[model samples]
Target: MADVSANPRADREENPLERQRELMELLSQETRHSIVQALLGHPKLLASSAELNHFVPSKSKKTVEEQLEVLVDAGIFALYEYPPNEDRRGLPWKFYGLTEYGADVLGDFNYLEGVPMARAVHRKTRKPEQIERHEAAPRPPLPESVRATFRLDEETD
Candidate 1:
């Protein structure tokens, strides 16, 4: 049998998780992350480097193109030249979209599903009983004189 290590396809198949991890690591960078997110949100759409400016507004066109090329080389995206019949420009626009593998990986991209309190963290609500139980410093009782002056000691029966 041929050594799987010698074959990139066989190596990727043998450890599919590794490929996913590699994809994630590459996307950990802000530019790459933005590019992937843009593609994911607009599947099957071919976006040129100029068009991608909205997704990565902070980056220059050159920087965006460089990152797009990196994603293209990684097999996460397929790059294509704009049709020749289109209006000519200084440089031919390159369009990019997710590859089959990229789409498959994106299908499994649910890393934020378990993100705790991402939506509710800002809203005020009753503190959980667990937190009160674990609190190191219990609140001190108000002095009777101070409570009486503020009528905080008044109780309705």
Candidate 2:
């Protein structure tokens, strides 16, 4: 569980950056990360627990349910109950979707698109030095014909 400050004034003062950091921490958990990615990727499409099981097949249902509750409590996920018109059973199964705030939060992190500078780190593989070297290297000159087509040759003249 994340630590909550008892002092309201103190909490207010510290919340701006801390809020984003807290969200990042929540997303850093692999299961939670996967859940968020799946939800965001699909937008408003509601996903049932059974459908979501595909994302974290290795985890027990209890664990996944608990995590879903955590996300719901955090306001990152919206839970939907089926309409009462249908003759459903006593216990209503819920479907999950990203809340508006959830979509904004995930968008802020560029979670759907690949991370800009972090793409080099794949599957826990870190090659910071290589990434730095790649960035520092200059691009090769464009072919003259291609450049001429774009009127770059006139710019030089």
Model 1, range 40-85, lDDT digits (tens) per residue? Answer: 4321244555446555778887888899878776655666554452
TM-scores for all candidates: the values are: 0.54, 0.56
lDDT (0 to 1) per candidate: 0.50, 0.52
Off by more than 4 A, model 1? 1-11, 88-93, 111-157
CA RMSD, predictions in order:
23.5, 17.7
Question: Scored by Cα lDDT, where does model 1 land?
Answer: 0.50
Runs in model 2 lying further than 4 Å from the true structure: 1-14, 84-93, 114-157
Clashing pairs in 2: none
Against the hidden true structure, what lDDT does model 2 obtain? 0.52
Task: Tell me the tens digit of each residue's lDDT in model 2 across 26-116.
Answer: 8788788766654443212345565455546677777778888788777666675555413543322456755555555666787746432
